[model samples]
Target: MSLRANLVLATCTACVLVLGAVPGTAGVAQAHAVLPKPVAYPARGQLAHQQAMDDGACYGWARQQTGVDPSRIASAPVPVIVPGGERVVGAARGAAAGAVVGAIGGDAGDGAATGAAVGAVAGGIAHRQHRRQAAALSAQMQSSNDWALSSYWQAWTACMTGRGYSVQ
Candidate 1:
């Protein structure tokens, strides 16, 4: 083999070896994206608040109906629980990691400040995504509750109508 060809082969082999080393590091980073530890039950007040709001809505609906007073309604609001702790932790962790990455990519003197700004933006984006997810889940839960409430109200109205009362 020619000297030039041997040198080319050696360079190509080195490049391949360097590239191959990158995947292991990438895999470790990917693992860090996993959700953090589960939040304890004590931090679940939001679930109770959601249930109270649902109950209030149903109570208000019953009160507005002419045939059935709020006191007579047997319907109870269902509770909804949305898990958000994981998303919050994930965003924070992602931001920290992003800051480190950005610092490495920035100019030496301004690296930390640039990294912090970039990290904050990235964190906000992640937080927004989490909020969207939480909103979607809440919507789904509310939709299900509405369906159930509609059916219950319809049945109650029918019963009132059968008893010689005009249901508006």
Candidate 2:
């Protein structure tokens, strides 16, 4: 197939796989519904048992419109490594330094072997250190992203539910 076709197919396949893998749970189900178009919400005082009633109405409406269980929709957590450029740069720097150190130790004849061994060990250590640092940074970034996304999604979902719209 053409490159474009292959890319499209790959993307579609990935999306399908992701959707299929999502856990089936009440919160997830409620998050995936088609948000009502031109969302309408009752006037402030018109809502009785406001939160619960609104959630139920939205869930039922979404079910009727989509023929899918509202309880099965789920919100996926956003991944944290989206901004890993800096970590990549740091890894590249470490690799260059390791290579230089290796070359410096190499000498003519036996010197070359000695230098090579030293360089290999140095490079390996540098690479490991770089990876460990990057991993730690990535973890921190992921945690922050998770917190922010979770908070935003929660608010968004609550609003949609209040508007009698199923959200996922």
Which candidate leads in lDDT?
A: 2
Best by TM-score: 1
User: Pairing residues by index, what is the TM-score of model 1?
Assistant: 0.39
Cα lDDT tens digits for candidate 1, 1-168: 345434543443353344332222211111112112121221233465554454455445544653444232224332333322332333345445544664576533233333333434454455456556656665665565455445556655454443333445
**Once superposed on the true structure, which residue ranges of model 1 sit more than 4 Å away at CA?**
1-109
TM for every model, in the order presented, reads 0.39, 0.36
Residue-by-residue lDDT tens digits, candidate 2, 1-168: 345434543443353344232222101111122223233355454454665566556556655544545223234422222221222233334445544554575523233333333434444454446446656765664565444445444554565655655444
lDDT of each: 0.41, 0.42
Candidate 2 at 150: error in angstroms?
0.5
